[model samples]
Target: MQIARLKTVDLHWSEDGDPDGIAVVFANSLGTDLRLWDKVIPLLPQKGLRLIRFDKRGHGLSSCPAPPYTIDALTDDTEQLLDRLRVKTCIFVGLSIGGIIAQLLASRRPELVKGLVLSNTAAKLGTADMWQERIDRIRKDGIEAMADAILERWFGEEFRRSDEAMAWRNMLTRTPVEGYIGCSEAIAANDLTASTSKLKLPVLGIGGEHDLASPPDLVRATTDLIDGSRYVEIGNAGHLPCVEQPDIYAGHLVRFFKEDLNVGAI
Candidate 1:
């Protein structure tokens, strides 16, 4: 739980595995923290992977400013973290808004990113009106007002029946209102279609078969933008596949490192 005190925000982050190992940074989605990747992290082979997971600004233990953060600002926060840690090379694994961040990061700092695993995200998330509606609800009724709907979108009925699902639900509701609201605003404004398509590095797009937020088609469409990129849709898992299907999700990432990037080749 070290803090990277950037100019805009102080990020809470954890760097695990060997320092000399290849850097693999994990970024979380909306309404969740670094802990979102907890299940999937342990499942990853630590032999030659230096895993980095962090709470984005305003999420988890990270410092919060106010409402309405831009995607550029979010990207800046990530860059600062990487620079501060002196991470020379990385394979960024990002989910949802974090996936968007990965796209932006690769475009902005190609030297830093060697490959990517983008899961459960799109070029553009929701329309401005939809984001506005969510913001209105949060401002009026608070985060609890939208917790149930978010859970439904994040996980399926079968997952909802378990204690793990309940735990995530609580995590969603506990997320700072400003954090959720700011990220939502950024999602509404962001469109990484042009930037993502230009990336030539090895990429593996992971989509959840049951995902309602970023459906399989949506994920595939984004992957298609990048020439030579590959796609896989995880079965039975909803939006947060890493939570509901940690083994499968982790397997995909390992395969990406071993096969796609040939991580040991470095």
Candidate 2:
């Protein structure tokens, strides 16, 4: 139950493997907590890496401040958390809104991030009007009402039919409405295309074949913004590829660390 108390919020964070090893920090999606990476962590190299993950403000055990959050503020929360952990450099893995945070954080504090793995995300997710409409609907009907439709966007048809999806549904419905809406607002207001285009660090972009939230084309398009970033697509998966296809997702991550970043083996 490690907590990093930032200037404005207390963020719940956890770490595994060697504390002195090179850091690999994971930022999760809008509604999920740090546990989002549970399935993928064990599959990653444990020899020379310290896996770190945190729940953003308003989610998990983290304190909720209020509504109407900005992406920059969310990035600041991440930056502060890392600084508290004394993480001078790291490989950042981000999914969905977490990916947006990665781009902004890398741009603002280039010295802190050594590389990035962007999954099911883009430089700009949706138009303001679209996000506003979604936010309004959630506010009106609550997250539970949208869980079925959201699950469709989040998982492939096969996963949704399985029993495992029930737990995910519970997680989604249990998320604090204020936190979800706040993060939604942050996504609505952010467009990191300009900043992301200027990033020069090693990057790997991943998307799922059945992902409707941020499709493969959009993910690849964001990857192309970086000068030398590589892109891969996972089959039989949707937005949360890490959840549905941990083996393939982890394989790409391991390859990126070894081949692209020249990291040592497990």
Candidate topping TM-score: 2
Candidate 1's TM-score reads: 0.98
What local lDDT does model 1 show for residue 9? 93
Please list the C-alpha lDDT of all candidates, in the order they appear: 0.91, 0.93
Candidate 1 local lDDT, 50-163, one digit each (tens): 999999988999998897799999999999999999999999999999999999999999999999888999888778899899999998999999988988889989999888
Please provide, for model 2 over 84-203, each residue's C-alpha lDDT reduced to its tens digit, 9 standing for 90 to 100. 999999999999999999999999989999999999999999889988988999999999989999999999999999999998998888889999999999999989999999999999
Pick the lDDT winner: 2
Model 1 residue 139 CA deviation (Å) reads 0.8
CA deviation > 4 Å runs, candidate 1: none
